[model samples]
Target: MTDNEALASASNSAIAAAVARLAEASASGVPRPPVRDLIGRDDLAAAYAVQAALTERRLAAGARTTGRKIGLTSEAVQRQLGVDQPDFGVLFDDMAHTDGATVPAGSVLQPRVEAEVAFVLRAGLADGPLDTEQVRDAVGYGVAALEICGSRIADWDISLADTVADNASAGAYVLGTDRRTLAETEPADVVMSMSVNGTEVSTGTGAACLGDPLAAVAWLARTARAFGEPLRAGDVVLSGALGPMHPVSPGDTVTATLSGFGSVTVRFGTGEAA
Candidate 1:
């Protein structure tokens, strides 16, 4: 087979195996093996295929499709990875959490914390050229969210493509109680700051997310369409993080403060005893 054909075959095999793994994880309550190991090709195409298959299974099981998430939206992250833009992932009902709730650290592998903005989609958006105002109109409200990320990989060292296939290392999110109308909040005009252990660890501005976080959401909606799954209504799309990712350990409290949307805080469980 030619290279393209070989890749296609490999992707097909990976997708099937991924679906099986998903079933196994769900049944046994164990984390699935890192996609990098399960699939020989740790690329975005393979990852998206796995995501699509998993999404199909979730929909079949009566799970509600809420929205999408944009990862690596920070310019610092992009520069670190040598990429100019962000990646996307799907979000289901089970992946959400309410603010002021404590998240058990045991639920994820290699968990970390990130501060972000979330857009609740009021209208359907698909592939097309989208401007900032158009994106703002599509969003009904915005919330302060703390993204908890976990890696299936036993070890954290991985490439961008590998990370993408690992579902953008998404674990869960805590949505703040405070919600603001999009018309009132211009994503670019706000600043983001994160503190860990009562000390400021990182800081960034909303403009870090492609000039405007709403624009990031717009890019995600279009990108989802290009990937064959268009964004839909009632989706709470995470517009990406405004600051650097802070690694979390047991007994650590992570807090992200947005200029106007309020803040989200999560306390992690203690780490394994040495």
Candidate 2:
């Protein structure tokens, strides 16, 4: 066997092992140790391979791919995670929720919430220049969004690869109803404020998301295409957090207001929020 091909086979084996470890954690509701020991701590390719394997398994089991989510767009978050570049993860249909929906507890392990702008695409990103302009043109509208992130790695002790393998640490998402076209709402200029039970906890502007939310989407489009799976029409892309993500407890109400895009709120099911 060729040297490169043989090494790839070994890598694939390692990725599969990592995927199984994470899946067990998710199924058992017990976070496991970092999978980085299997897939090198910085081996993003192998980590993504684990992600793909898990995604395929889910798809085979009838779980539908709804969209994609970008992570680490905030410079502060990037610094906190010690990564300069961002990562992407696939979103499943089951992870989506509407405004005012109550997310029950125990569904997400180690839940943390962050506010973002979500774009619903009007065109496919398969054959485009994958630039900011093309990304903006492809968007049907933007809405306020809240991403409830979770980790399968114990205590969230994860490297970049570990989180990537855990589907960018995605948990659930909530979208607002007041949507507006790109011309109607300038995402980069919008301000964000997130409160829990009427107390403000996080605040930021759309520009905090990789300078502009559109730029983040453009990056995701290019990255996904390079990975040989470009985004499709009608996909909902969750732009990375505009600020820091805050953890929640049972019965906490999370309400995020995106100035131009309106607000999105999610209630923890009586005692369910992390």
Candidate 3:
């Protein structure tokens, strides 16, 4: 075989190995080691390949695609990963929870909570220029949201590729009922406060998310189209976390308040969230 063929074979092997490790963690509810050792930290393409394969398996298993999630929008995580941009993951239908709902047991491992803004799209992003203006026009409405982040990597000792290959460490999410227009309340100016069991633990503003949640959505739209999976109407986009994420245990209740956008709450329950 030629050198190029050999290299491709090795890459395919690595992607498969990483997928198996992550899939086992997801199914068995046991955290695995970081996948960067298999896919490497800088090979983002290979990392996303693993994610795509995992997403395929879930779809084949009857999991319905809900939307997509943006991750690593925070500068701290970017610095940690040595990257300038962000990454994304697919959100399955089973990963959604309504406001004041419970998160089913084993839905995630090493779970943490962060507040964000959720946008439901009314227009397709595939044919647009993918800018803040285009995203503004595409957005149906904005609502306060909480992204329940969980890591399959034990202790969350993850590199960029590790998290990317692990589907951006996505868990479940809860969205608020109150919706606002981009004209009514600009996302970049929104303030966020997150509390765990009545004690405030994290705080931030919309600017923390790639300068603005709308900007983040624009970035995701551009990236997703580049990857051949563009954002479409009715998609629920989680525009990354606005603040530090706090850990949660069973029976812990998380509540996040978005200034001028009301709040969303979720409970960590012993049984299934449904």
Candidate 4:
């Protein structure tokens, strides 16, 4: 192999090994050292390569791809993560849950929840710049979704590369039953409120997510295509969070209610932390 190819292969192997270590940490419910710390560099390209390798490993192990998730869309989240733009991650079939489901707290490390809107696509979208209307038209319906985010990095100390390498810190997601077409409602105006045990914790609007949730979906379509993976039909894309993420623990019952769309609830089981 050429020198450039040899260097690329070495980097890929290093990233793959880091991904495997993180997977072990996830399985054992323990947070591992950040990949940046282990590799001594913060390269976004290398981080994405690690994410792709881990995703391929999951797929090879029989986990089916369900869709994609957009993260760091809200200004608040961006500020929190110290990033200027958003990131994308792949979602698998097993990561999806219906409304009112109980999530095993042990399955995730440093679990948190965010309220979001989910787009169920009816047609495949190709790579290219797309308008909001185009993105809206491709969606079969939109539903209330609660994204369960977890970080395998110790104490959630993560940079952009760290989180990206960890699949955008994606854990699991739950979607509400209420579905509506874009024509039925104004997605930009939809408001969402999240509560834990009957007490409100966070509130935000659809505009908080990249100005409009549909715009975030459009961005995902374009970005995924640029990465050589276009969004497919039947995919459920989780538009980024409308508000700040709320921490959850065992016995916590979190509910997110969206205007026009129904509410979704997830109860955490009594699994001890690692």
Which regions of candidate 4 deviate over 4 angstroms?
1-10, 38-42, 272-274
Candidate 2 segments whose C-alpha is farther than 4 A from its true place: 1-10, 270-274
Error of 3 at 235 (Å): 0.2
Q: How far is candidate 2 from the true structure (C-alpha RMSD, Å)?
A: 2.8
lDDT of each: 0.74, 0.90, 0.87, 0.86
lDDT of 3 by residue, 128-206 (tens): 5899999999999999999999999999888878888889889999999999888799899999999999999988899
Tell me the tens digit of each residue's lDDT in model 2 across 98-130: 999988877899889999999999999988589
Which structure is stronger by lDDT: 1 or 4?
Answer: 4
Task: Rank by TM-score, highest first.
Answer: 2, 3, 4, 1
> Tens digits of per-residue lDDT for model 1 on 171-234?
7888887899966777788798899988998788898888789889878877777665777778
lDDT accuracy of residue 177 in candidate 3: 98
Estimate TM-scores for all models. Answer: 0.84, 0.94, 0.93, 0.92
Residue 216 displacement in candidate 3 (angstroms): 0.6
Evaluate model 1: give its TM-score. 0.84
Q: What clash count does candidate 2 reach?
A: 1
Error of 3 at 106 (Å): 2.1
